[model samples]
Target: MKKFIIGLFALVGFSAQAAIINISTDQASYNVGDTITANVWIDIVELQGSNLAQPFIGGFVMSLMADATSLSYNDGSIMFGDKLGAGALSALLPVGFGVYSIQSAAFTPSVFTLQAGLTSFELFSLEFTALSSVSDALFGLTASVSEFGSFVGTPVSTASTEFSVEATSVPAPSTGVLALLACFGMMVSRVKARR
Candidate 1:
């Protein structure tokens, strides 16, 4: 039993060393409101499956702020495709190590508009909080951008393309203004008659 325990400890240390997290963005600097897409992934190629479902990977969505007063919340939703059958399963990259398919898609140009002048980094939370489950511990995360009117594109190795959303807050001329002007003209005529 003592020998078995020692061997297990060594194995665990080796496995932990094998697991690493890598994050990359297409663009580094983003405007306060610019919509940017980022990709996250891992390096392992094979994972053994368990008979049960497991959470192997996930990510934190955040945006960098320009200033305290210049930051605002950008609202968006996350959707995961290619749902796997729940069970003890091993995950193999559709491609190979350091390569992966799109597990989730993010709508870009940001479906949500940010507050004007609020330049800060904000993380959009995931709708599906669970990560992909594989037989082993090698896990990775990635993001696909879906701008305001578009959908996600094909998967790639790196995340890039950082930008900002411009705030549009102009009020158009209202019918109320025209009515006020007419009323003022009528008052002026009445005053002129009295004089």
Candidate 2:
């Protein structure tokens, strides 16, 4: 019975170290032509009172999907976070359509490892321009970490968020402005007739 209890505790400790992916935007809503900044984060903190050491990640591949019609991805706007450490190589792979793949890895396995800690670290960020107003502009993400400390790979849960875009309103012309425009039109017509 004691052996079974120990095995159960080990299973629970292993599950607690799984990474979590998070997606967030700078604002709750946006307007047409406005820029939106989306940030991706990974949380690998171990559960409190767990004896297992936090696992470090050597690299990660993340794919982001956005509504192409409503939000246009900004070229050259992919930025990696410092947690990846120096000498980390990254690339922005345009998969065509509306999916973007971001891959980053340490040049040398021993050069750096996303250190284990009690907090989350920023994985990367992307920028997009609001093309048109939409009730819900959806963004989706899927990611996995490779070369985890002594482990082959770890899969992170998929995450998504919705953004709203509202159209910018143009003020209507006032009555006085409309009357002035009519007077100007009449004077121009009169001059043209004289000529």
In terms of lDDT, the best-performing candidate is 2
lDDT of 2 by residue, 1-195 (tens): 999999999999978644378899999899999999999887766222254666556778888899999899999998888666677888889897889988888655542444645367788898999999998998899888775333344566788989899997889999999999999999999999999
Residue 90, model 2: lDDT of 89
lDDT of the structure predicted as candidate 2: 0.80
Superpose all Cα atoms of candidate 1 onto the true structure and report the RMSD in Å to 1 decimal: 20.6
Give each model's whole-structure lDDT. Answer: 0.33, 0.80
lDDT of 1 by residue, 80-114 (tens): 22211122122212343233333332323221332
lDDT of 1: 0.33
Clashes of 1: 41
Q: Which stretches of candidate 1 lie over 4 Å from their true place?
A: 1-76, 86-156, 172-195
